[model samples]
Target: MATVKFNPKDILYHYCSTEAFHSIVTTHSIRLSSMSLSNDSMEGKMVEEALARLAECDKCDQGTISLLQAQFEVYLKDVDGFGFCLSKKRELLSQWRAYASDATGVAIGFSRDYLELLREEYLRQRDPFLGFTIAEVMYDPEDHEKQVRPLYQQIKHAIDEGDLLEAKKHSPLRSWSNDTETQRKKSCLASLGFSTLMATLAFAFVLKSEAFKEEDELRLLALINRGEIKKLGFDVKSNSLRPYREYELKKFDQCTPVIKEVILGPKHRSPISVVEDFLRCNGFGYVHVSRSAVPYQ
Candidate 1:
């Protein structure tokens, strides 16, 4: 459903600043930011909100509610999820305004097929611990509502007609209070419930605010263990350290380069040859470059 929805033949544009463009062309990689640390303060809240709506359970004791909320936050911070966002609209003004920084940047175009291959490669290796998915962002309410319904049903089944709030197996937030046989059963069921809820995260990552429907975003997201992240790199912006990992784009095995085209932003006053020369110098001679048709200054 991913490549089908986004169209593998379509070129996904990554709008970035001129400096970022230089870094990309030189390194042949893309940067992904942790979802929890994205510019949107509501980045990781959608799943929680959707679960509340679908469960329709009345509020429980303040202590119980706090525990589940804490668990959810722990899960997000436990396996840091990161996303590399791209737009199907090659020259969308909003993207140029948002990601193209200072109204003077470029949109680097990459092949959808190549990106898909990279995702498949990640899965193909069967690392078992690594998780990844590429998909078109869902902005429609009714459409995504249908997507989350099945998970809600599973949760309902797990609790057996008792609402999620009533299924309060809150023995302890982190571990069992005692090793009694009955307590062990409760702990097992609680683990099952949380793990089921975890399945909703992939959907959560690809769903975005409708106010941004114009961007028609597609995301290549990676969710990995916190232990592995400690050894990787991060980027600092706005005085905060964000976990990030770069995916290589340049192909060295005598295949077409993943980068296919580039569009100079409307206010990108650099000559067309600047991008062209860089591509050629970096062994990407087949890439096509053009100026943006938008009239924005």
Candidate 2:
């Protein structure tokens, strides 16, 4: 095999949040623990076979692994923040468990049909907020606008009717919230306020149909094709991007175009410069980029 060289600075990293970084790390830690435990349970060939099977099951496609390694290299360049929200951690843990279960099932010679079933279950249980975030960054703004229009209308109608339950049902925090009626009402109102503000901003900046020139669209498509921009859990079909899998985005389904956050990475520019460039070039002011806190190993 030929030796390959890697230069960290040439990679672009993308992450949903600090919580997501922690989750990925935590899952790897647990897998390491399992490998160690297997050593004590079996000897020699048995242990080697077990380890090989585990490694095989844990393997991601080369393209994905390369992408992840590049992201981690960028992350290691700067590290900050130790704490993660409890809810986010739990949500990540659930996803980790599902992934582990599916991999293990396949390694143990489970039926291919069973593996497919597990895959479907895993998709159903993933974090919708993260999914939306990925979709927003990876997809064309026009494609995102189509996905969120119906959900936006629903949220507006629910708020206008003063139906807290209905409004909460359309919130991104729907699964995360377990508040009393008063608290739920307060949460609904807060979300409404934020949405209204975002709507105004979107109209002024993002929703102007003419804001994106033909050349700008071509530029974005080129970036995506060159892998400078990565879109997770979505695919381009018929010259438009759409979610490639099912996820929980019902609450923010309509507002995703207006509210989803975009991430800019140092691979494309120095940290200080990327933000300014993204805002100016993308024509949307809601882009987010990490400056100091890197939470991944």
lDDT of 2 by residue, 1-297 (tens): 222233222222222233332233233210011111121222111212222233234563453333333322222223211111111121122222232232111000111222223234334654322221100121244443443343334343443455544433444445544558656665655554455433322221111133222212100000011121222243343565433222221212122221122232212123545544544453433434333222211
Those runs of model 1 whose alpha carbons end farther than 4 Å from true positions after fitting are 1-9, 57-74, 126-131, 154-175, 179-182, 193-195, 250-255
Deviation in Å, model 2, residue 80 alpha carbon: 20
lDDT of each: 0.70, 0.27
TM-score each candidate.
Answer: 0.81, 0.18
Per-residue error (Å), model 1, residue 170: 5.3
Residue 213, candidate 2: C-alpha displacement in angstroms:
2.4
Best candidate, lDDT-wise? 1
Stretches of candidate 2 off by over 4 Å are: 1-145, 163-181, 187-208, 218-297
